[model samples]
Target: MADAPLKVDFISGAVDYRRRQGGGRGQALPKALGFRKGVTPDVVDATAGLGRDAFLLASLRARVTLIERNETMHRLLAEAMARAAAESPLHGEIIARMTLILGDAREILPSLKPETVLIDPMHPPRGKSALVKAEMRQLRDLVGSDPDCAELMRVALACTSKRVVLKWPRRAALLPGLPAPSHQIVGKSTRYDVFMKLPAPAGHS
Candidate 1:
């Protein structure tokens, strides 16, 4: 028999636990996209799968906009955010900083001029036999493979004013036929490839 479907919850589950234990801006994600030039700029989560990363950004006080193209996933994310909002004052505040939009990020990103555009598009599997994490497996099953990651990367680079952050596998090759990131933040298993949109001109010595 097929294993029972994973429970997709944002509150009072593993997701909640992780958020509560987070290390603020010290974590890789926040560092990759937050505290840039001393600014905790607002973010557009262009591929907001499950919304955990976006929630982390919101908790650290950056306004986050989550865009999910899948109808069912968007509905679930909206419901979870609503539930979190109605829970208490603190949770409500985080939810307040978050806005959920149901649409294609490529189509929607150009309309808004955010300080940063974060693209955490799906990654290809790790290996043949290595077990896929349950959460990621569920996401892959739902959204299928990401054929347009390169295109999305191009779009994000064009849209955001300050920077564009791509959440990618640590060892995976950089997206082909795209401009490389300014630099990367390498964690144990994930990498944040940050592309600066408008880098400052260097000063003369």
Candidate 2:
């Protein structure tokens, strides 16, 4: 039998993240995801850990699909979205734009026909000087490292039409087996590596 799911306050966490928008690291992510003033791309957050980043994107009015394969995490995310939709004033709208899927991205990405795929795989802890947040520490405890992240990237590249974005520590090594990013958005502690899809062959499209 499986253990009971862990509980988390994702609604409150998302609220706090929203309150911090337009300031510090918060401002960098949306731009990295290709968000513009009046355009909201459809996004698939392939590794929706606790749904924080996914919520951020939806709060900016982007339609987001959150995919989490862990049953415990999936339950927690579902509850958080439900509570936010019911309690948080803007979250109703936010949750409306967000969808949840309980499955692996490798098996799921092809069917979604994603325009953008966002990957933030679990990585090793940085040097002792860099403190991992409580939420992130808890996530690492639950999910361990994402060993197949390279495969996830490969699957995302094949399915996504516009671009695939990867969030990694600024100083961390790029995922093995992936090519260099076309461009990058660097922040103080993290960076978003973007890979744009090739245009379809004229005869094929």
Candidate 3:
């Protein structure tokens, strides 16, 4: 029996994001990723779940690299990118600015250079009333909780020259073992913790 083709739809999804809210720094993610007028730093989305955020970043004119470790998710993301490029005019340009990689970010981060690294590891499920979105529930069922998120954060901090942004539930406690974020951008349902790397002191080896 033939397996069903993945039906992930990033084109319409990104359009919805742009149409509903005007995709820009006003959004929590772009704000946390340091998106500024005339400045679109290249970024790596370490946990490129469904590529929603990656697509958003690409639309904002940043070159984005999406990394997904889960084989199933990677396959779906790849198919989604292909479909968007073929079907959506905006996505043609978005696809040009985006790249997809298959591997665990901890292994790949050391080899790449990006201005910002975005990590949105799967956290514990939300309360009963605030049940997770359908897509998120499917992801959770497939990938389970991210147990190595702390290590992933460490690798991102070491490799990234600018900052690392982590998407987390607004009410959940910060991920343990990570230093306090330099600042945060809060949204209605989620918050982004921004950790800016300290500049090396002059004349210091």
Error of 1 at 70 (Å): 0.5
- Model 3, 23-48: lDDT tens digits are 77667788888887877778999998
Better of 1 and 2 by TM-score: 1
lDDT of 1 at 111: 91
Give me the displacement of residue 174 in model 1, in angstroms.
Answer: 0.5
Q: Which stretches of candidate 2 lie over 4 Å from their true place?
A: 1-7, 13-15, 23-26
What TM-score does each of the candidates earn?
A: 0.91, 0.89, 0.91
TM-score, prediction 1: 0.91
- Candidate 1 vs candidate 2: the lDDT winner is 1
- What's the ranking of the predictions by lDDT, best on top? 3, 1, 2
Task: Find the number of clashing residue pairs for candidate 3.
Answer: 0
How do the residues 1-64 of candidate 1 rate in per-residue lDDT, one tens digit apiece?
Answer: 4656644566687667877897477788888885645678889999988898888788778899
* lDDT accuracy of residue 86 in candidate 1: 90
lDDT comparing candidate 3 with the true structure: 0.85
Local accuracy of candidate 2 as per-residue lDDT tens digits, 1-205: 4434455554664445564555222377777777776667889999998787887778777889999999889889898889878976776888999899999999999999999999999976877824776666678888888989999999999889999999998988888788899999998988999998989989886
